[model samples]
Target: MGLDFSVVPEYAHFLWIGVVWTTVLTVSAALLAFFGGILFAMIVLYAPRLLAWPTRFFVWLFMGTPLLLQLYLIYFGLSQVGIDVPALVAGIVGLGLHFAVYNADVIRAGIVAVDPGQNEGARSLGLSRAQSFRYVIIPQAVRSVTPPLGNNLIALLKDSALVSVLGVAELVHASQLAISETYRPFEFYITAAALYYLLNLLLEAGLRAVERKVEATR
Candidate 1:
């Protein structure tokens, strides 16, 4: 259907607020997930079998489960066990952890993609293990993984909407509230979808720019 100018004009400010919330949630969640994922990736890459196996299990568990179910478990299921995390915290942690699991694999692949000879060169230079990793291996791995990592980040941005179920007042939540009051399902949902699309488009463009910059430095 055509754009509902009447509803759009009336709710523009409200929708802008929702977009801001969505951006905040997405960026915060992405940062959390990236750090967590990198930590997990390091463990899997360098830790002993004993440590790596459990880490692997965690990655599998989070990656295997549906994100929506994970959110519910954190927000609702935990409350059943008398562990009450606030809705916002649960939402951020759930999505961040979930993305971290998948991003771990991508990171692992990036590390693996780095030339084995580079590690050898670092070792031959009398660099310690940590030095070698910090200066050589990780740098290349990051370059190799930038595209995939950015894709995961963008996915995380869109997935933030799943947290709306917990009433986080994000974009989807704002749209739902508007729909409830205005009784305009089509307008609200279509607007929400368009906003999400715009978000992804902008993120993709940013990632492309980053990729180019990284490539130039290489």
Candidate 2:
């Protein structure tokens, strides 16, 4: 039989909604992971021994496990214990937390890449420790941080597909629905692949633009 794409219009809405859910998952989780990572990195770098070990344990726990397993524990394991989390919330939390550990490590490396003397110099100039970090250290760290951070975000975007296993109705799920009904796996799957690729390209472009803008300021 010759290939036909007439069925695409019939499922356009499904694809559109899938795109939206995928975006929501990626954006929400990215923000959570990014900001949460900063705090975690700070704790690792500066927190007293009383608090730092526990934070390290948290990071280690997430870092050592597979993300899919983490999502299962959050979404299904919790429900087994009578604490039901909605699908969207589960995806966001699972992806956010799993990636946060990795981001924290990347951010910590970036922060540490700055010379120790700069930090001591800032303190010597009479700026409070927090102010010195906020003004001088972080800005300098951004130069080192942006590339790896962008890579993490790109990886996160691809990982969003894994959430469909939890029935989040993202692109892969939508493609599955189309395949089931129309028995046109190639068309739908190809479409989904194309969408993912295009999104990755756009994201890379955006990250590059950001990197260039940051460079301009340097």
Decoy 2 TM-score against native:
0.93
Instruction: Give the best candidate by TM-score.
Output: 2
Per-candidate count of clashing residue pairs (backbone under 3 Å): 0, 0
RMSD of each: 1.9, 1.6
Tens-digit lDDT track for model 1 on 42-114?
9998899999999999999998889999999999999999999998889889988999888788888888888
User: lDDT of candidate 2?
Assistant: 0.92
lDDT of 2 by residue, 160-218 (tens): 99999999999999999988999998889889999999989999999999999988887
Q: What are the clashing pairs of model 2? A: none
lDDT at position 42, candidate 1? 94
The TM-score that candidate 1 achieves is 0.92
